[model samples]
Target chain A: MSQVNWRTINVDALDPDSALNFDMSTLTPAVTPVSASEVQGLAGQIRQLLRGGDHEGALRGALESVPYGADEKGKEIHLHTVIEILQSIRQSEMSPLLSRIYQSEGGSELLDVLMKYLYKGMSHTTPTGGAKQMAPQATGFSQIHPLRTGDGGGQAMSVFLSWHEKLVEIAGPGSIVRVMCDRRTV
Target chain B: MAQPEIHHLFHRPIADHSFSSDRQTLAVARDNLIEIYGKSGQKFALQDELRGHDKTVTGVDIAPNSGRIVTCSQDRNAYVWEPSSSGWKPTLVLLRINRAATCVRWCPSESKFAVGSGARVIAVCYFEEENDWWVSKHLKKPIRSTITSVAWHPNSVLLAAGSTDGHARVFSSFIKGVDERPAPSVWGERLPFNTVCGEYLNSTAGWVHGCEFSPSGDALAFVSHDSSITVVYPTGPDMEPKAVLSVATQLLPFMGLIWTSENEIIAAGYDCAAYRLRGDEQGWQLAGSVESAGRPGMDSHREESALNMFKQMDLKGKVQDDTKLKTVHQNTITTIRSYAGSPERVRQFSTSGVDGRVVIWSV
Candidate 1:
């Protein structure tokens, strides 16, 4: 028999005085607002914990303070932040955290969401042909590199990720992540 | 994975099967007898028994152009037999070798055939003066070790020989003049890393058991005692190691290696597993694994062993007892030959050990 455990978000664990705080406004359909000063404070605290090599503690704090199973947009932002923090974890010993995420209920769905957002962010923005003559440009964000074209480099990177995802799918979330992390350390 | 379906074509134990160039008829060697069978499994009855070799025949080959058959045996004589209305009879017997003739291979054009013996020398014989075949030239420079396997390139006039000395050498046709049979000249050599068990050098110089040339004639594949298959190519300008596929854990002391196609190589070892290594794959894959059909009287012997040691109080009981050994059909697969005419035919050819059983596998 197989078992699954869904991890719960503990947003109350965040210290009120920390330098980095989770901004409530960036979350779509904002319900509450946290001052920029508070987010800066929380970020500082995270940096200090990382420098002190308290990786596990820092990761736990970040995961606990994130809102999960919220509105779709808000959930997306929260999950994105969690992915960024997990990626930043330096020590290979932090594999247990990844394993816990993989084994959690709805783990596959969460990973799917993460992959969709990552792929969308890497896609190129095309030029608009005739969109109401752009009555009033909201914010101009020009394409960065004109020479960056074609799918060769991006497709190669995607192929590698696809292979990794397929392995994870075959191994299941929990044990596969733990094994991969352990192998990385070795 | 599902196991392959095994069909029994012939119940009588056969030693080996050499298909005619057209693959319409099969030349089978069983014990001291040789029989030809048609494609329909009907005994051609063309020959009851070819009376030439005294000992059990070890290997057999059929000329590509002519339908002449060659059989080698522990009798230390390689006989060339021609089919006639009455029966198959020996046309010529090359009797100059000291050790048992292990393998015989006829060139593609059927003009010449090479025979290897335990004597470490490869003798090339040619069919000269109608109906008579004689040794045109021979390499007496005995390979530093016993020559266990020999194969001719598909099209080119070249021969590849593998020896127990952990090396496979390629030789070019040295036939000087049409009248003056010439000796073969050494072209190149390929040496693979020693076996992992560290017995590469000390192991008997007869470890090289199998050798074959790819259909393209650009590469040669061979196996050693270490259970590793090495592929060597001499056409590349730089002579780089083209490909090396290891069956280290699957195949041990492979006795037969043959190319099923340009990209697939099939090899069978002492173990019952038949392995296939794809051209693009990094390692050999298990194509077929077969356990012995059954062992007769094996259960009773084990029970007796325990009784003899405990209740019987027989202190003189031999620990390595050979008398109670089970007579199972686990003969080492000696040779594997693909169908020459139908490349994708269902039945592939193979030969075995003491029983001299010839098996046709449906692929």
Candidate 2:
């Protein structure tokens, strides 16, 4: 019961006889998804810094703004704030945020730094069985980041799903299986 | 409240968990068997395993006073386990349902048990003294979908069932011979078997995951897939409820909920945390999460070697923080049962989850 992604389920796939026939549309109304403009406004400075080719500067702001060391409640609000920014910005605008963080000096490190907030933030918001594990095959960074063409990050969950997908995609094809095999011995 | 006791028993998801009346014994339904654990000084050690069902055991309940364990499974069967001098004796129950049995609960009187099934029916089983066997009487009426949960009212005759059909309905399981005449209440006056006392569909028509009766059994609280908890206070049978307070939240939907008092409810699900909901016949609202402290490892900046950092970077293209959740239960909490207190004034409750953890927390 906890294994499948209930949200990702296509509504038409529901079997009348099965227990999974939960109408997911009930979720859509509560999702006051951070509006695109609000997201743009929240991430305005970071957007400007990235567009101006100051990748390092944008990465710094992304990393510095997070209250990683804050207490539980403070961290939750801050994470939501960061998530709001991520969820708000359009993929056209957000893709650059990812690309810049990856392209800059120690950009990979910055991506990792940024990912910490994303990961921790998601854990905070999602309910127990509600959290979904993105398929391992989809865990490729290149396919995930979409570099220029952003397709999957349209929904709220895509933000978390895109993380590992981009990770494996960046490593190219066999790296996931290879690296896992290497880690097994180490 | 002292710290919660964490028992990481195994890797398998715990379908359901129950503590003995004395709190010295624990029963957990795993894949196909119900594992019984004896609580030692502070931890539960595996004492015995009851194996009878061929398929996954979906639900298990321990009758407080009878010391009998009732378990139902995907194999379309239910078993009553009685502790004997040797170990435990298993008595087969004739559910007669074709599809998988989803959940089961013993009535407060412990004389009867109800098994909800995918066959679109609830099998109310009781011991037929003449036959000397557990026999079931089907409550098949307006149920449209698989039953996910069933909560027995304090009176034992009123049963609340939440189903995938997005409805939580109240029914009369009154057996003429077995059950005593229940006093007239807001639920109904004339009660008969399979009587639909009240029927409620989720406001958003989402699948109802959990349904529970208040301590007084006058109110019902259910959590649905819409990430909302609704409290229903009945006015009278076959009439509009006095209040149907639906408290919606932004978190993911809850898997199960329990009423601690007439005005207090605690629900836990996919969010992996239990949240408190408080209200009355007037209005109800989400109080907040029961646990506030975030996941561990997120708080501390542990120093690691440069080599370690490089290895993480080399392997995953980032320094991943793959640590367990900060909450007591690291995964989805499937069921939260009252542990240390009575229904009205519960002092502590226990939650078992997909992570195979049984955590007892103070209320």
DockQ of 2: 0.03
- Candidate 1's error at B18, in angstroms? 1.1
Which tens-of-lDDT digit does each residue in A61-143 have in candidate 1? 54444332244344334433433444455334444544554457534333333333233222222111111111211211111
Q: Write the per-residue lDDT of candidate 2 for residues B24-139, one digit (tens) a residue.
A: 99999999999999988988999999999999999999999999999999999999999899889999999999899999999999999999999989999999999999999998
**Residue B258's lDDT in candidate 2:** 80
CA displacement after TM-score superposition, residue B140 of candidate 2 (Å): 0.8
lDDT of each: 0.52, 0.75
DockQ of 1: 0.01
Alpha-carbon RMSD, candidate 1: 25.7
For candidate 1 chain B, which ten residues in a row score worst on lDDT? Answer: B194-203
Per-residue lDDT, model 2, residue B36, is 95
- Name the best candidate (by DockQ): 2
DockQ scores for all the models shown? 0.01, 0.03
